[model samples]
Target: MVPPLALDIDGTLTTPEGTIAPRAFPLLAAWEAPVVLATGKAFPYPVALCQFVGIPERAIAENGGVALVDGHLDYAGDPERVDAAVEAFEERGGDLGWDGVDTVNRWRETEVAVSPTADEELLRDIAAEFDLAVVDSGYAYHLKSPDASKGAALTDVAETLGHDPGEFVAVGDSENDASTFAVAGESYAVANADETAKRAADRVLDRGYVDGTLDALRAIRDRAKNGE
Candidate 1:
């Protein structure tokens, strides 16, 4: 069996404008492996997509702040800690909040997701005030748990699912996913990924979005077939 896949949804699964690629749904539907949709998306989408793909039982969301399985939600940080970080940012008149990100992304229980338009340095400074952590999702700056992260969660899930970390393929195109890349046995970055993200990958695809993903997957499958 192929190593389980841990994928980021934004630029890797969707187009640059954040629309789901035309090939995405079908590609996922036909997959026959233990794959986790790892992303910064809050909810519903994670759960909803999981349902659409026959894995409605588990998801990784909120940049690693949340883990959902069998409709159960697990959080890495306490609400009080998250709220204090939020409050610290709010002390600056809450101007660091992002409005351009997906509108429904408001229910950030474990972290506050801010748009790129927000002051990155200021946001980091605010999190520092309360000993919180701020990480970039390529598109947003998230104030989140000091320890729980996309990479850590991916590794955790892979282990729980009985796969060695070396048997996991982590894919993404953002900063939040950098951690996932570091922990997984193989890492792939789409053509549209940022420089930092691309640098972290073991392989760089030629295409973007799901097309690029499918292309790379085919090569991996071929390699296994050839005993290479």
Candidate 2:
């Protein structure tokens, strides 16, 4: 049987330029086992991704602050603390690093996503004050509840789907994906992965971005065939 999959979005499924790779659609849709999209992006983002990819709507969104599994919605991270953290950040003369309307976080439900262009140190400090954690997704900096993490969401979703967390293989490429790497039975980081993610993964692929994801998928298929 094919191993279940938990994949990160930004640097794993998308191109270096951040657009979803066109090739991923058919492969993901045709896969026999469950495919869960785990990302720091908002809930709607991954939900829509599943729809477009022609897969079941299984997603861990907002850095695990929110999750949707077969129509069952679960929420973690505290939006109140996120609001406080944002207020503190602004008070310290920090910008969420967006001009005008802050669309990056407009539709976000449970946590706040800040631009990587913002002051990382300041964001971390404010997050600490608000009892939140800061995760650098390579695309953005997310301020979220310490209680939220991709690993936790994966565990929950796996159980709900009648599988063990260790039955899934994970693929990702950033600091935010580290939690998932720690929990998956097998984990791969793309060549472009951040140092934190590389150290956490079971294997680091030679290819980057979408190519790396394809490589990981091939490896998984080989493993299944060889019964390894």
Clashing pairs in 1: none
Once superposed on the true structure, which residue ranges of model 2 sit more than 4 Å away at CA?
Answer: 226-228
Give lDDT for model 1.
0.76
Can you give the lDDT of residue 119 in candidate 1? Answer: 70
Q: After superposition, how far is residue 141 of candidate 2 from its true place, in Å?
A: 1.0
lDDT by residue (90-127, candidate 1, tens digit) is 77766655457546356666776777777777778877
Q: Residues 92-211, candidate 2: write the lDDT tens digits.
A: 988888788877888898888888789999999998888889888888998899999999999999999999999899999999899998889989999999999999999999999999
TM-score of each: 0.89, 0.97
| Clashing pairs in model 2, backbone N/Cα/C closer than 3 A | none
TM-score (C-alpha, index-matched) for candidate 2: 0.97
